[model samples]
Target: MKRIKNGIISLILILLIFVSGIPAYALEARPQITKPDLPFISAHRVIKAEPVYRVLADDKLHWYTTSADEFNYWTGLKGINNDGIAAYISPVPLPYTVPMWNMVKNNAEQYFVTSEESRDYVIGKYGYCDCGIMGYVVALNDAAHGNAQLYQWYRGATDYVYPALAELYGLDDNKWDADHYYNTVVASISSYKYEGPQFRVWSDASTLQEIDVLSPKGGETLTGGSKVNIRWKTMIPGGNISLYYTLNPSEGWSVIDEDLENTGSYEWTVPNSAASKAIVEARWSYEGIDANCYDQSDQYFSIKLGVGTPINWALAFKPLAMKALLAPAAPSNLTAISNLLQLKPMLYWQDNSTNETGFVIERKSTGSYEKLAQVAADQTKYTDSSAEAGMTYSYRVKAVNNQLSSGYSNEVSKPVFKKPEIVIPQSEPGKAGQVNMVFTLDQRDYSVNGVTKTMDVSPVSLEGRTMLPIRFAADPIGAETVWNGTDRKVTVKLDKTTIELWIGAGIALVNGVSTPIDSENPAVNPIIMNDRTMLPMRFVAENLGCTVEWLPASKQINVNYPH
Candidate 1:
């Protein structure tokens, strides 16, 4: 009778495996369970180092694990597909272990605990209920023995796990590839949050923690007097960090903040200076070791001169009216700012409406404002690359939807400025008895009366104005030139015209009358080049009764003076 009973039990086990689709060989020995010997803990059976498998069903990720006896006895299991193997421990604490408690609110939002205080605080404050302990994990990173770094990421209310640190948002040290994760999360839900590295656990290999700089992210054109958020991330243990910035790499670094807590972010007020190649660095040091670990921007960014003042966003705002169901409220705090990179004017405003499809931007042109562009809903900023340099423009933004549109916000104007370009008018060839001179940009050799001549300093374009050595420019055109070392002034006399210009000055005197060197570009003025005085080619030559024309094909400037 005992043999018959054993035979019936064996037949039932075989039938269960056949029905559940769990292979018979999958019935491995159950994990050895151990109860915590601590006196404070009570009424518990906690499994240690239990193998856990992640399964997908009903369009949601779920964690599944069971003992060997339970797996053998289970029958007709559906929607259970083993993706990969993972490990977990119990609530009971062990040596070099931390208890990971399960907390739930609406749904499971976060897991992978840090301390009992944190768990209890969330439970009491966030209305989360304690769901008992999930498992224990290694407290510190173990490098000698290979172990994987588990990452916890969540979207909406469901928390998911990644086998490796980089798997979380496809991010690695100095590399940010959020496109795949963004698409996945955005398609499924609206909100996504990243919970940084949790406890280290056993795996095939150990991942080295690194510090990664996340922003200014290179190629950004930041303006002076504006506050910028320098952001970074690190998995290294808590230590004192320092932040530094450099306008030019060869000039060394200036401290933005020193001995700051490793908070991963800092607010910096940009200096009132312009730089084409700017970099930011974040350094982590512990135990008085300088340069222990550090990371900087992967590529250089730019900081340009602007209105050296912060925009009072609150003061710039205009009153808002109640929103109607058909349309959103008008945008507020519209302001246009100028930057040095490409001289593009940046327009910023506050999004005041929730139902608008998009905002329409208009620029004042000719006699009235015209539509410039339309950006998607909730977009409060726009860059006007089409704005002509040296031209002042006014802009306004308004909310719009399919059915209706909101009123335009308060208008803001900004005068865009860019590095000037050499401008020469179209002119006919010089007549006989005229001195014709040709100078190519960046070329030291020029021609006077069709004869080749060499100059110590090259003719170049600076701030959109053509610059040439005063002697080379005026002497070839039958103009007598004099330089005043004390006043840093250059005086050119040709026939009855007299032109006087001061170095670094935007205005020049022509025939004793004050005149701008270049009206279109205010920054166009005289400068010193290679220990020689350089004057604006167009301003000096034209004032001396000469005609100037630009040769685009060969980048040559032609000056003709009637003799």
Candidate 2:
């Protein structure tokens, strides 16, 4: 209902005060000079407490200014015709939890408790309080919760919102009107918490100093195949800070390119691979002010690029120039081909800077640089044939012209690793010591499936195999194993936890605990030979949620994972 207490306090106060005392004060034997202090006292006494109008402060608090008021204090809490009800902000020197958990649960903060009727005015239909009664905003951590007054319930009068939440045990008044006092709190700690802190981004270096980046945390390094999160930490907590980024001297930086709100941090990435020089800049562009990350003085402020970044300078392009980069009849696609995997890095740019001589793709683990592939002088494309199966590799592509190179392209970091292989050994139908296993694997490398025990560990060489329990080879397949021999359960931690497979006797157990594996799980019945246990890979892979692709032409089995 758009609470107007804080919004219209001046109007209400003006209407209530009388001018009779003003004229008499000045004529008080010329003693009216004390008018400034006298009127202030009378004003505060009106509310039975000291009340000071917010004013401008030079420091961060912005102390008494309306800008501060609009942003912090809720209009719903301006002034309530001397309801004789008030709330104060004071630290209760006791168990922190005692006060925090209790008062907050009641939508109450610190020392003042709102009447049931008052509660309805805060959250119920058309309820708004005088700004003066409500304490100054302290802090807001989420769009749902922050120090800003903008996020204070939007003064909603929804029947469900105020009633259901207020109905929780402890309101004391069965007829309590949660709708009236929902906004009674300067800061309410509702159960539905805003998970991450509010992020602030700015282009001005000065403001940037005030912000803290939570993601891509300082001193934290991400090689290939890692998530790039950009978060902002600020003194003034609020909901949804927009993030911004850019590279290139000509195209000055901006606050946020993405439209998300109250995001303290965002997912940032540079071509999956590390780069020698790439700006992974972050800015909170949500509000009108870009709280941090702008260098107004400099035309182009390149973010401090770290070492070992795989960069392709030739393909870098500014967002506004995307249209121009595309209009020039140039194909922007890189086709990489690999037996097991193919990873292609994309690049872009707005205008033609110099002689586009393609780009250089570098790997950090080893400072080896490769001309992986290239595009036309005006073209923007690169193909990478080095994606190793089961192994992760990082990649980034930038554009380059004869004169100078553009800032490195945005990062495209992902790791490429080779998949592992598993095989089963076959034993001579009637022979105990004579067993053989030759695995035709799709991937090149893998690890032992589980901790030993299911299979006896003695292989003459990597060639011969015996009857070993599946548990011994479970790890490579990404399976978690727990068995005391009787109640055997294999857990594939990839997606879910299970306890329903008893090898000897088919059975299932609840998750988190152990159960028996089923006999049907194994293709072949246990044939004790060479003093080892052996089972089929198909059964294990399927139960573990792994994708098994069998190639009839080459008799190859590929076991992949979501597991």
Candidate 3:
């Protein structure tokens, strides 16, 4: 009777295999399956080195293990001795797994297929082979989740199992090939090699966590200086959040707010500058937590020229509106004065407009106004060092903002006169140690060691301070000047004192120490004009052991040596 019972059981098993259209030999070689010990049952399970099974779910392959000891070893979960358990596993590759899992999970729902159907398909085709079953699961999951690359990941294993299954099912080989499943599976496996001994273990399932921008997503035209509310969504509960923006992707990020609470929304005031392509970035982090996430706008948005418009404007009104809002008020009290100390004419104006971005100075020569110089809004004086001697000129001043110009101010006229030649007494033949020099304000000629030489570029007053040509002034005091063309710097050396100044730079080095040009004395900076290097007369002259005196009434600069 026992022999009969065993024979009946064998017959039932064969019938089951035959009904499922799978070969009996495929199940005969299957590995013995065993349940794991009890210790592995936990919210998060660990996996160690062991032969584990991969299961099919919704046509995707997932890690699963029946060994509790292996689970405890991998995930550090403590299991009681002899405690038997079974569970599905989540295999996450450390470090190499990109942080795009949140995106995958959010999109995975659309590709979800019946897990039962996928399991039945695997059992019907590949019988009970663990790897083959998992391969089918992975292929189905790939198809459902739109993960073409993942399908390619297990294509090799699937290809070996597919032909035999088709033969058992009695499906036409020509139709199967025509359907292109065989070709597709073959093609998918081409890019990848099957790396055996793949990791598998059971653990607590992880939830998808990500941040998404709800509003102002992209393609919106926003105005500068206008207030807007930025909205976002995240699975994380509460954490520190910050906002950032960038004009271009390659550039560094500019922080919009650093200490914002993760309240899902922020009120932001747009910047005043206009940009056609802009991106907004949001970052979130928690104290003492390992999970930190960030997101950026998927597409570029625009910051346009208007101050308070959300919609793109009509072409005709944009130009007019931009002009009206940005134009500064005209400057006033424009004056052109002849300086006897220098060959150039100095112009001064009253900055009458509070909103002026900058001042533009224009000179009229031959009845047409020519732009001479543009100065910062705070600057009220400019020297026309390029002006030729013995020429009459008319000057006007105007204010500007964002390339918009205001009406010209009252014009002022001045006549440039040729300076008189200065004569100096010759130095004593035996006196070699001491040098003496004198320069008068508005005078084109300076005396060196009691001898005078004509100067091509003269000393001039700038921002109420006198600037002199360094090459001429320092040479008279026995200081040597070296020009570094590569660095565009001028080095002056005189008796243990070394001064370094760069052209168009505001900082100077006095005896190897950095010193800024005095703000109150704007002329202290070294300037280059028409190939001549000029420096502040007081800074260079006083540092070299000379005393400077100003004759306010006569507008003369007097420098005495050995003081």
- Winning candidate number (lDDT): 1
lDDT of 2 by residue, 1-563 (tens): 24677658867677668544476657567434543422101000000111222321111111111123432442233221122211222111111101111111122111112233443333221112112223222233333322222212211111122222223323322111122222223455443222232111111111112344444432334454344665556443442344443343244333334435644656654433333222333333222222222111112212333455544333433333322221121111212222122233222322222334555444332454444555556544444444554443454445554433444433444444322233432222323432212234333222222212222133111112122344534554445654432111233343474533332222334455433333433223222222222334544555666565655565444445432
lDDT value for model 2: 0.32
Per-residue lDDT over 1-563 for candidate 1, one digit per residue giving the tens place of the 0 to 100 score: 99999999999999988878976567777778998533211111112245434443223433333244433332213433444445433222333455566554322233445577876655433334444445556655654321545555554311232222223224331111111011101133334465545666554322333567788767899988889999988764566677777676544556678668888889998776777767777766432223234677877888878795543222332212212222455776576656333268878776656678899999985579999999998787889989887688889888888766877888878778544222222232445557788899999888766667776558878776688766787765556777764344689998899888866567788888989888998667675542345788988888777899999899999888876
- Candidate 1 has a TM-score of 0.26
- In terms of lDDT, which candidate is stronger, 1 or 3? 1
For model 1, what is the alpha-carbon lDDT of residue 458?
86
* Error in Å for residue 519 of model 2: 26
How would you encode candidate 3's per-residue C-alpha lDDT over 389-473 as one tens digit per residue? 8678889988887756777878877767464333333353225556666677667766666566677667777656777666666
TM-score of 2: 0.22
| Off by more than 4 A, model 2 | 1-367, 374-386, 390-397, 406-415, 425-563
- Alpha carbon lDDT of residue 141, candidate 2? 33
List of clashing residue pairs for candidate 1: 89-135, 89-136, 420-463, 420-464, 421-464
lDDT of 3: 0.52
Candidate 3 is scored at a TM of 0.25
